[model samples]
Target: MSIKSFAARIFASHIRNKIDKWASNPHNTQQKVFEELINKAKDTRFGKDHEFSEIKSHSEFVKKVPVRDYEELKDYVDMMVEGQEDILWPGKPLYYAKTSGTTSGAKYIPLTKDSMPTHINAARNAILCYIADSGNSKFVDGKMIFLQGSPELDEKNGVKLGRLSGIVAHYVPGYLQKNRMPSWETNCIEDWEDKVDAIVDETLKEDMSVISGIPSWVQMYFERLIDKTGKKVGEIFPNFNLFIYGGVNYEPYRTKFESLIGRKVDSIELYPASEGFFAFQDRQDANGMLLQLDSGMFYEFIKVEDFYSENPERLILKEVEVGVNYVMIISTTAGLWAYNLGDTVQFTSTKPYRLIVSGRIKHFISAFGEHVIAKEVEQAMKEAVAESGAEISEFTVAPQINPKGEELPYHEWYIEFEQEPEDLDKFAELIDRSLQKQNSYYLDLIEGHILQRLKITKVPRNGFQDYMKSIGKLGGQNKLPRLSNDRKIADKLNEII
Candidate 1:
């Protein structure tokens, strides 16, 4: 088993080296590069079957496979959970990385030997980009922390299997690994619950110079650090120079997190998952880390106009329209072909392919008939904060259907700050005005007052992190979703406000 795994890794490395060469070419046309990748995807294999064997060509594959969400993949997930290998891959998958999906509840994303390299390489590239950001290649020579998911894999009957962390830990390069932490933190082998505690405890013991995880989880650790030392974030871990996070938007929570840590550390955005690591923030400021699309997977983007224009066709990456939201599809070395990841992104520029995440299409707030998309909310919040001239440490907006009081639903914002605003009412009004100005649809809805009210609740300093910890989702994989459009969360926020 070890020998076969090693061989698979070698083949992957060789492919990656070739890709690096192609990507480095200054004049290589994207069309030529994509066609080459499509050819490669057609030939890569896992055990006996070719990955995406069902599709003969990239064009055919993209045309035939309708974009799928987690629900559409439930039966495939059931197969992995049942340890069936015939349909998906040759043998049992390495481990299932538990991930949360909208409506589907808890999902076990399949991870196999072929897929693991994407995570490693993507992480390495992220660090490398950070190094470029810092202008120091040796930036990661000091201690580093990875806030990730629980290692335990669930068995067919719901029994907890061995730790997924342990299984993948050893694959990490030795020179950069931390010594104080147990092998499990890096190994991907230990049980999930144990691994979380172990990672947290170990991080507490060391002079961690760099930390990486979801912002929500990182905030939870800050709260824990405060309780442990009675020291504010800036005082407790003032030495940390680099703070990298992904899995969720960091803008809303940035102010509160930076305040606790007492320093504005440099940050990098990582786009990764059990299936594959696709992109990272590039080292250069202007160049969004050119997505390492040529890595283990081929990427495609669907135009938002086409997506919403009654036409159901998908758009290829080369054909994406700027400023429109599109779902990302990937065909990876792992056993997936033309897989829709459900993440929505909009292109900032087409030349180098810079983009900004626009939030999940499946999870927007449409309550009370207000088309308050994530981008609309983000822009409104940014504009409001800018207009109010009052600092916002952190904030989240939920659409609420007020029970008993009025038939019209409203928007409520939960804001946390280091200090209180002089006039809370004006601050809320500013936010409302900004939303009205930015989105025409929202403005139309507001004119009719479809959403009658906007309410703000000031949270105790450091309260948001406490909420994240309460959920048992600190670091690595679990993230505090920016917009929890669920009725339950909205109802709870309404009660608190």
Candidate 2:
């Protein structure tokens, strides 16, 4: 092994031991973090208003601070944005990780001095965990390309404002600077297509190994590389062995990605966001990402079914169970308290507190009370693809509650396929049956004729891409929602089709 690789093994071994200690006793680890966050932020405007000083226990804390999304907590955040000190946390945030909001136009999530290192460490530790497990550090010596947002940042008031990925770019370790690809100037290209072209030109001939990015954007990068060289990615980057991805599940794209690579490359999943780095895949053979119990954040979960109730029971790490879909709520050192991230996750392993992000709170279809989630649709698509020998590039689901004529409203699926199934109708039927197997409400709707069997709209090649591009959201940490509650995306998709 090279000198760096040898040193990496030793360091990874140490990190592995450290992680095992906390993972074994998750409740205590999380309790300490919870206490720290409460103490640290008690003097802030929000803390004072919520009576954080009187909160002595998790139950007390829950009663004092109601779970809130960005919109509900906007007043305090707005004060902080307007240069008020100690509004949300002690002093001002180090940066505002800018992101597109669902209801609000743009959200400025705080990244505090205390919470920033945890984000960086979670990413670094994910790789170290891989190295420790597989005993492979050879990839570190090769060129590593992180297809990410432009590092160029703007300032609002006194705080640096940039996309979470862009802010992370500024923190690339000096040791990896020589190994990182696509020079800074190329990354700063504002236009995503132009950026991909620049990236392709820069890394096409390099000894690229570790490629990290959101899966959809990385898929685009792979397509461009193949277009340019007319070779599988494996042939172009012979040493490329690891792909680290985040933001979206890769299961649906696995077949397409493997085809593009021409071989199987190991991958690591990350659960990161502007609020805090939540989890990362700690074991290659494990079922789900390891919850970061000690990452300066305290986690609470509400069963998805009970999430909308006026008084939902909040369960701490010790109270959660496997297989139950729960909406994640967090109180972080970054000053977000009882924050509803709007993402729902299901525990795969309760012993170590590992979870899979199953879906989103607001990103589901229930127009006629079918209440189908992203996980159900994605799994159905995966099963159908396996059985029908089909290849899907991208897809989305929406409730078509108002179809013309006497036709019954049904779930509309816009699918972009790389290879069309021979019997397209049978393929759709397979997907419908699989979904019915997973969700009973959906099954009831079909059985009762409240809705017809789901309809598939074969979106032309690059149809979803064109839709995303039309909305100026073509790349860089952006994800196509797997399902929606309304016809907004379904209508726009039809426009592109």
Candidate 3:
């Protein structure tokens, strides 16, 4: 074996040992993590304001600091952005990971010295865990191509700001840097199309062993590679074996990605958000990602069913049950206290705490009291694609509410297809059927004549891309909301189409 591969195997084995030790008694360690984070930030401005010193127990912490979304914490975040030191965390943050926002134009999340390492370490451990579980280390011998955002960062009030992927890319370890592709200059291209073209030019001939990115963007890269080389991904990168992805569900895109690669590769799902690196797929046999309990964050879960209620129960790790959707809340080393990250997740295992992301709290359609989530929509789409033998590139759903006359309101789907199904109506029927089967509320609504059947709109190729680009959110962790309550996104999509 090569020296790099040998070294990586050794590191993987070491990490596996540590992970096994950590997982042996997760409950105690998780509790300790909460205490440690609280103590660590007790002296910060936010901590003092929230009376963190007086907070000793989880219940007390919860009572002291109410769960807040980004907008609620914007005042403090804005203070930090305006060169205020010790506003959230001790001292100042190293950088700000800018994410797309709904009301606000951008969300500048703090990334501290402590939190940054957690992100890097969690990602490293994900690969290490896979290596330990599968006993495969050949992927480390060659190059790794991370299809990420622009590494170029802009400075604001002595704080650097960029996409999380780009920020992480800038901090890639020196040893791994030797095997990483797409030079910093290439990665700095602001326009995604231009950046992707540069990436294709730079990494097409390299000995690629692993590639990591959101599944959507990765598929785009694969399509571009195929068009350029007239060869499948496996031919272009013979040693390619690992695909690490997160951000969106891989189910709908799996068939198309497999076809592009020409074979199945080891895939790892992660739950890294702009807020923090939360979970990673650890075991090959597991259905959900193992929560990063030992990471520098304290986690809380509020049941999604009760989330809208006036008095929702906030459950700690020990209180969470398997098979319930929960809105994740966190108190982090980055000075976010009882912060709601907005994503919803369902726990598949509680002994070791493994979870699958259900959907976003905001990205759901409940216009007619038929609550349909991203997971359900994705599952329905997968069923439709399988039954229709069609290939979907991307899709988004929105409610068509309050028609001018007596027309019944319905769900509208904007779909971009790689391979359109021969029978469009049949495809639409299959999707509608799948949704009706999955969601009882939807079925009830249809039966009661409160809602019409879903409408399908086949979008022009790259319609989503064009719309995102038009809004300056084309790439880097910006995803189209799968389900929206209103026609805001739908109307925009219609305009694009």
Task: Report lDDT (CA) for all predictions.
Answer: 0.61, 0.92, 0.89
Q: Per-residue lDDT for 1-497 in model 2, tens only?
A: 89999999999999999999999988889889888888888899998999989988998998889999999988889998998999888999999999998778899999989889999999999999999999999998999999888899999889999998889888889988999977999989989999999999999879999999988889889999999989999999999999999998899899999999999999999999999999999999999999999989999999999998889999998899999999999998888989999999999998898999999999999999988998899999999999998888999998888889999989888898988899999999999999999999999989999999988999997788899899989988888999999988988887887
RMSD of each: 6.4, 0.9, 1.6
Q: What is the alpha-carbon lDDT for the whole of candidate 3?
A: 0.89
Q: Give the best candidate by TM-score.
A: 2
**lDDT of candidate 3 over 142-243, digit per residue (tens):** 899888888888999998999899999977988888888888898888888888888888989799999999888888789889999999999999999999
Q: Candidate 1: where are CA atoms >4 Å away? A: 1-58, 89-92, 101-106, 152-170, 179-205, 227-238, 287-289, 305-311, 383-394, 402-408, 459-476, 484-486, 494-497
Error of 3 at 369 (Å): 0.3
Model 1 Cα RMSD, Å?
Answer: 6.4
**Candidate 3: stretches off by over 4 Å:** 403-407
lDDT of 1 by residue, 1-497 (tens): 34433344454455445545745652344445445545544433321233344545556655555555667767766776775654444445566666666688877766666677767777766665444345544334456676654444446544234333433454568755552243453435334344545555666666677777777656666766776778775565556777888776667666667667877878888776666776777654653445665555667777544655554666666677678778777665555555777677877766666677777766576665555667777777766665655555566677666545546667777787655557888878877887778667667877886766577867666565455445554344544445656566545444444
- Model 3 deviation from native, Cα RMSD in Å: 1.6
In model 2, the runs with Cα more than 4 Å from the true position are none
Candidate with better TM-score, 2 vs 3 = 2
Structural similarity to truth (TM-score) of each candidate: 0.79, 0.99, 0.96
